[model samples]
Target: MEFKFTAEEEKFRVELREFLTKELPDGWTGGGEEEGDDWDFELEMRKKLADKGWLTMAWPEEYGGSGASHMMQLVFAEEMAYQRAPGRDQFGTKMLAPTLMIHGTEEQKREYLPPIARGEVQWCQGYSEPESGSDLASLQTRAVEDGDDFVVNGTKIWTSNAHHADHVMVLTRTDPDAPKHRGISFLLADMKQPGVEVRPIINMANNHSFNMVVFDDVRVPKRNLVGELNRGWYVGATLLDFERSGVEYSAGTKRTLEELIQFCKDNSRNGRRLIDDPKISRKLADLTVKTEISRLISYQIAWMQSAGLVPNKESSMGKSFGTELQQAVARAGMEILGLYGQLEPDSKHSPLQGRIEQSYMMSVSATIAAGTSEIQRNIIATRGLGLPR
Candidate 1:
């Protein structure tokens, strides 16, 4: 396959870059730290992207989206990551909306997808439980049907952005009698409903991005059911594959690495420039090669998606490698900065706006969240390499 971008695609890329350079909000970079909950920053950023029709570039035009090619979507993701613009909270636009587009009834699509596309609503995922982190199928959160309403009762830990979410795409047990993997259901629950409580779960950075969401007999209408009852495991797994398929790690981490390289040039260590070290140059060269490989893997996934192929293994591999590579790059920055890396954003002389310090902490979470490095390896070995688990 031809790896180079088409003439038209290259032209579009230049135009998008120019637009982002001109339009991106000042003082905004993708990483570092945001001051508030996911909903607030996401809504504002979504408006900026939505106004440009960039949020729905991969979605169909009938749904108020651009119906752009998958390559265009990749371009958009890359540009946004490079510009350090706030990301579209993955639950609404990236994870749930894609599943709804594929499986939701017309009513469901009309009800949910529009607001998400227009940046009018925000959502979070309620999948993992306190006891069921990696072993997702063993989750015991139950949703018993009563007439037209389903009463949801369980606690979901690490529910990212749940406190400020307008809705939650929740995975619940609708058939306890069925096998572990076959008894689940995906339901859209209104976060504002009675009996739904969100308690903050602070992270290593003292930031409150995750939450413990307790659903105490929360009533959700039967119409909120996604696909068929007791078949949510498959649906949720498919959606996760799509969610993990994006190339954020390569694009996003590369941005930080570039910034760190500049930091090395601008800053000093041992009365000399950090970049003057031969070891630093060697590490950067290796990182540059790895970044190129990551870009290739990401482009392959985009090409597969463009060709209407299910990107299961490719996405898994991409997430697996990209995330680990991010951690490596962050560690490299820490090595370069030495004592300066310890100085966080609040410090007066912290390097690169103290981003290296923030990334050093955040990158650890990236490896754990969205499926751990160990889990990704499991997927790649079992599914991609056809190895026995």
Candidate 2:
């Protein structure tokens, strides 16, 4: 396999790195978006990225993007993630737009696509429920058509950015009698309505990024529905396909690994630097190899997309292995930090400003979000390996 990036891709990476350096504040580690803090900066950064055409670069030009190649998108995502930049909306730009392009009406596209491409709106995914996370087709959220609207009444848990969302891409069950996978409908619901309630769910890291969003008789216009009615299971799966193809997991882990490497190089234990310890060196080396493998898998996904193919099992491989790699990196950081790894982010003497601690707390959801590791493995087995269901 040819492993080299084209000169143009390399040049874009250089320019992106330069832009980030000039725009970010001194010593910016970009933990604010992860912890759900510093909203104003995030908004400003979002618009800046939109103006620069990096926010939706992979989208087609007719939809307000530059029609960049998927490999270009991979490069962009890697740099943004490695820097921990906060502008890009993964839900809108990455997950929802491509799904809309594939399944939405012209009216739906006109109404929703522009705002997302321009970074004027925030979207939360209403996919996971109290019991329907991994087995998503079994969701119980009901949407009944009444005249011109669908009366949606249900609850979505572990919804990221719901409190700040202007809109939500939701999957609702419309035909209970049908098979679970064939009974659902996808709807674009306005979050500002009175029936929509968002309650906070503070994570163990003391972060409020996740929420429990309750839809009580929420009125969704029929015009907002994407794809055919009772086929939302398929629509939602397409969206998840886009969500799982991201390169962020590997890129973010690469950043974490770099920090851990620097810490080992600078710090000492019993008159010996941590990097000099054979076991520690070996562990880091193993992680390095795994991280590279994850990156190559991501590149393959992008290459496939550039060739105009939809990635089902390929994306699952990327998500499953990349997330596991993320957890592995976090655990390595904690082990290397020893007692100091447990320090809170705000503590004065916390190592790496307690980034490892925060990541360690946050990595618990890496495998669970988007889809579980088991689900990905199942997809690989059934779809990729051609095994029986």
Per residue, candidate 1 scores C-alpha lDDT tens digits across 1-389 of 55787786788889888876775556656444532434456567678778878788888887868888889888878876767666476678778887887778889998998888887777989998999988899999999999999999999999877877899999999999999999999999999989999999888876788899999999999999998999988889878878887877788878888888887788677798878888998899899889878988999988997787768878778888888898899899888888978897878988777888888887787777767778888888898899998
Q: TM-score winner among the candidates?
A: 2
Residue range 94-155, candidate 2, lDDT tens digits: 89998998899988888888888898999999998998988899999999999999999999
TM-score of each prediction: 0.94, 0.98
What global local distance difference test value does model 1 have?
A: 0.83
Total residue pair clashes for candidate 2: 0
User: 288, model 1: CA deviation in Å?
Assistant: 1.1
* Residue 295 lDDT, candidate 2, scale 0-100: 92
Local distance difference test values of all predictions, in order: 0.83, 0.91
Error (Å) of candidate 2 at residue 194 is 1.9
Q: Which pairs, if any, clash in model 1? A: 30-84
